[model samples]
Target: MKTTILPLAALGIALAVPGHAAAKSGDVQFKLLGTLVAPDGKITSVKKDLIGLPAGTQTKADDNVVPTVAIEYFLTDAISVETIAGVTQHDVDGRGALAGAGLVSNAKIVPATLTLKYHFGKDGGIQPYVGAGPSYYIFIDEKPGATAVALGATRQKMNDKVGAALQAGIDVPINDKGLALSVDVKRYFLRTTAHWYAGPTEVLTTRHKLDPWVISAGAAFRF
Candidate 1:
């Protein structure tokens, strides 16, 4: 799990940034990135298992690639704030004792995040940055997989949760026209509960680790 703390840390960064903010002050940068979402959906505990799950059952979420957009505003040449928008989908399958079992299907996630970054170098050169902030994972349109359906699971739900994120990346300038190539990676620490229901009755409940790595690379436009 990421110990990056919470979103409130963004409030304290102004006092820590170096005094060289005049060059890129008030600048805005827009980026269109191709992102990869890789998550670990391993079951941590089975709170309720009415369906008689076998011993040592585990789960793993699949990876996904999607298009994402990032918008950033520079408070100074060295410090900036950013947010991203995108949707990712995944599927969880059984492992260990539950090998070959399908657990969840087409789970969509909206990783709502905000970060405060500190760029390392001055303008007209390659710059590296590190950031941290809060994250809210919104789950949507999740359905039970074939194995669960066969075992009498009529519906499924994954709860929304608040978490933290840590990020590190770099930006390389292409020219003097505010064009750049950027690469970024973020790791989010999150946990949530999964519930399975049969018509009007709740049948099972489990806790899962949802730590995900988000990697992105693409063109950036700064003005």
Candidate 2:
């Protein structure tokens, strides 16, 4: 009886040791990813005083795919902090009454997000996570298109934005060396003001709500 108990106790410890040593504190992970930015929200004009425009004008942004990168530092086996950086360019066009008028404007958006993540499961398997935090958006290189130029608009601008972000992802281990494949999705709740100019005059100002959802898949290396 005593000999049988000793072997069973050793087997239990062996099974637990590998998982405990796999992911611990002070581990760093880096991921190189491809992200698809899809705009699932509407852009409504606060002021529609321009000619041939109706009240409550709205528009939609086009979808785009871009390269992204993320770095995560594990505080524990189950908790981590992650930072993500990416740049996406979007073409804004008229929806509803503004459809088929070509592009209204094009703008480049760079979002830097910091999140606190909670990871589930033990080692040697899939690690699923959920995260939430804040994001800072930098809007640059805005250009007015044919539709805006025809309306006597010379310049277009989008204000920089700061908003909340929510994220979820899963990581599948590829080997024992801490290399993994990651699939992630994140959403940004953002709103900003769009400024249209004719020479030195600010002709149109409207509130633009751009809640963009990002889906990403890539590889991660843990060290």
Candidate 3:
């Protein structure tokens, strides 16, 4: 009987706390962010390789910086949903036994993502959040590298794929108004199939892991 009463009393006190729901429901936030995209474009397996590949051949994708925007809406004081818009470009280059070889050049991707976030803290103070959600990676305008073209490959294609992202971030209030400083980080897990064709014949095919770390910092406005 005492334990039950103690628990109920604690809940009542917590609910009565001041500024508990400082970020009210139906609030909207807009952020303009500078984002860094760093991907692991390593070869996971060779499905088909007509063009001979050296033993222990590996690959890496170079990083890029891009401008991004995020829109968020609060469902409750502690829960919100957010989506981001951005396009980034990357280049996959050979490593290990096939060093200095370019495999795919100027591969652009639209990382479409939506997340449901749970936030902690009041509106006039620091709020930290964690989120997770599904993602789709759209590949565009990827060209066969110079080496691939020289090696009888004239075209390259990377298949679009479904993926997931885990996110964590913090929003720090700048003033009494609805302005904040925001920093966010997300880890994406995804894979894609690469195809290289020589004219009409498919010459090379491989599977690659494109797990990328995305970091962002920007100013946020809420109303």
lDDT of each candidate versus the true structure: 0.88, 0.82, 0.91
Clashing pairs in 3: none
Please write out the lDDT profile of model 3 over residues 1-223, one tens digit for every residue: 9999999878655534344235779999999999999999999999998878999999999999999999999999899999999999998999999888888999999999999999986444578999999999999999998888889888999999999999999987766567778999999999999999999999889999999999999999888
**Over all chains combined, what TM-score does candidate 3 have?**
0.89
Show how many residue pairs clash in every candidate, following the order shown.
Answer: 0, 0, 0
Best candidate, TM-score: 3
What are the per-residue Cα lDDT tens digits for candidate 2 across 30-93? 9999999997436655664554466445777889999999999999878999998888998788
Q: Ranking by TM-score, best first?
A: 3, 1, 2
- Report model 2's TM-score to 2 decimal places: 0.87
Ranking by lDDT: 3, 1, 2
For candidate 1, report its TM-score.
0.89
